[model samples]
Target: MQREDALRSIDVAVLAGGLGTRIRGVLGDTPKVLAPVAGRAFLAHLLDYLARHGAQRAVLCLGHLADRVTAWLAQGDSHHAIDVVCQVEPRPLGTAGALRFVRGELRTAHVLVVNGDTFLDADLRAFVASHRLSGAEASVLCVEVEDATRFGRVEIGADGRVLRFAEKSPGPGTINAGVYLFSAAFLDRVAASDAASLERDVLERLPPGMLHAVVTRARFVDIGTPESLAAAAEVIGEGTP
Candidate 1:
C-alpha cells in the first residue's frame, strides 16, 4: 500500500521564512534559501530534488521578504515536472506555524517538510515509507554528525522512536536534518493562533515516542552561515548525486 501511495499522494512543503540575520553581512536582504549557489538559486536545487523524487506539487511557506520567493517561483524555475505554490505568511510565524498557515493546501495526508536552508540527500521515498509503515504521526530525518553543537541532538530508541531532543551542545550525536514526514493529523495538533517553532514549540514539547526518526549517514548541509554558503558548490554542483 505504501509503495503505490508514496509516489503521487505525498506533497512537499518547504518552510522558507527565516530572517537570515546571522548571514546578513553577506546576503544583505536576500533570503537564505535564495542565495545563489552554482549560479542558480538554492531553491532551484531543492525543487529539482523534490521533483526528481516524483513529488508532483510543493507549497512553500514564505515570509521575511516573501515577495522575492514568490517571484522566483513564478519564474517557472521548476521545469516540466512539479508545480510549485507559495503561501506568504502575514507575519513571521515560526517553523511549524508556517506549516500550519498552509494547512489547507496539503494534498496528501502525509506531507514532506523540508527546511529551505538545509538540503539532505536522503532517499525521500524510504523516509515517507517508514512513516507510512510505522503509522507514526511525525517522522524526522536525523543525520549522524561529528559535532552536534551547531544543531540540536536527537535521541531515539532501539525501535527508532524519538526519545528526547537535547539542546544544542558540543558532542558527537545525531542532529536533526531539518527534513520531516508529517501526517495531517499531527499538523492539526498545532494551534492555528500560536506562534510555533518546529523544534522549540513542537518537537521538544511532544510526548516521547510521539515523534519518530530515521537516522542516516546522509550528505547534508544547512546554508545558514557564511562559511557553509561558500562551500555549497561542492555539495550542490552539477553532476551531483
Candidate 2:
C-alpha cells in the first residue's frame, strides 16, 4: 500500500500501563514510558517510530502514575495527532484484560499493539500489510533471540503461521518480540468481566492453526531492567540497530 494509504489505515495501541516493577528503582517515581533513553522519554521514541511508520492515531494505555505520563507527553507535543487512552486497572489485569478495557476505543479493522518496555526496529507497515494479506486472526512479530529461556518462544509453521507458543523454555526457538498485529475480531473474543492474560488466556486458547507468527529482520530490545535499559540507551545513542 502507498504511504498515505497505510498511514490512514492503521491505528496503534501501546500497552503502557505496566507497573515496571523491575525498573522502578532506577526510574523512581516516573512512569516507565517516561524513562529517558538517548535523551528523550522512551514514549517519545516509540511514538516517533510509530508515526514514521504511518500510524495516524495512537492510544497509550496508562496505569500507575498516569498523570505523569500524560504531562510528559503533553509537554513534548510528540506525535501531535496521537490520542492517549488511560486504562486504570484497580488491580493488575493481565495483558489481555488491559486490552479488553480499551476495546471500544479501537477504530481500525486491525490494530498494532506494542509493549511500552520493548523496542523493536521492525517494519510495522509491512507487518500490517502481511497481516491483511494473511487470513490469520492474529500475527505476532517474533525474532530469534540467543536466550529463548528468558522469554516465551513461539513456533511457526512453514507458511509462517504460529503452531505453538512455549513460555520461557530452555530450548532455542523464535521469541515474541513484544509486538503484534491483531484483527478486530480478536477483541470480541476477549472476556469483559475478568482479568485475562494475552499469552495464557487468549493466545493459548486460540484453536490450532489460527494464530500466525512472522519472523522479522529487526533489532529487538527489552528495557524493563537496568541493564537492558542501559543497552537501549546505548543503541539509541549510537544510532545502530
Highest TM-score scorer: 1
Candidate 1, residue 11: the lDDT equals 81
Relative to the unseen true structure, what is the Cα RMSD of model 1?
A: 2.1
| TM-score for each predicted model, relative to the true structure | 0.93, 0.90
Which ten residues in a row are the worst by lDDT in model 2? 1-10
Model 2: colliding residue pairs: 162-212
On the 0 to 100 scale, the lDDT of residue 117 in model 2 is 84
Q: Could you give candidate 2's per-residue lDDT for residues 2-47 as a string of tens digits? A: 5435546767778888889999999999988888888888888887
Clashes of each: 0, 1
In model 1, which range of ten residues has the least summed lDDT? 1-10
Pairs of colliding residues, candidate 1:
none
lDDT comparing candidate 2 with the true structure: 0.77
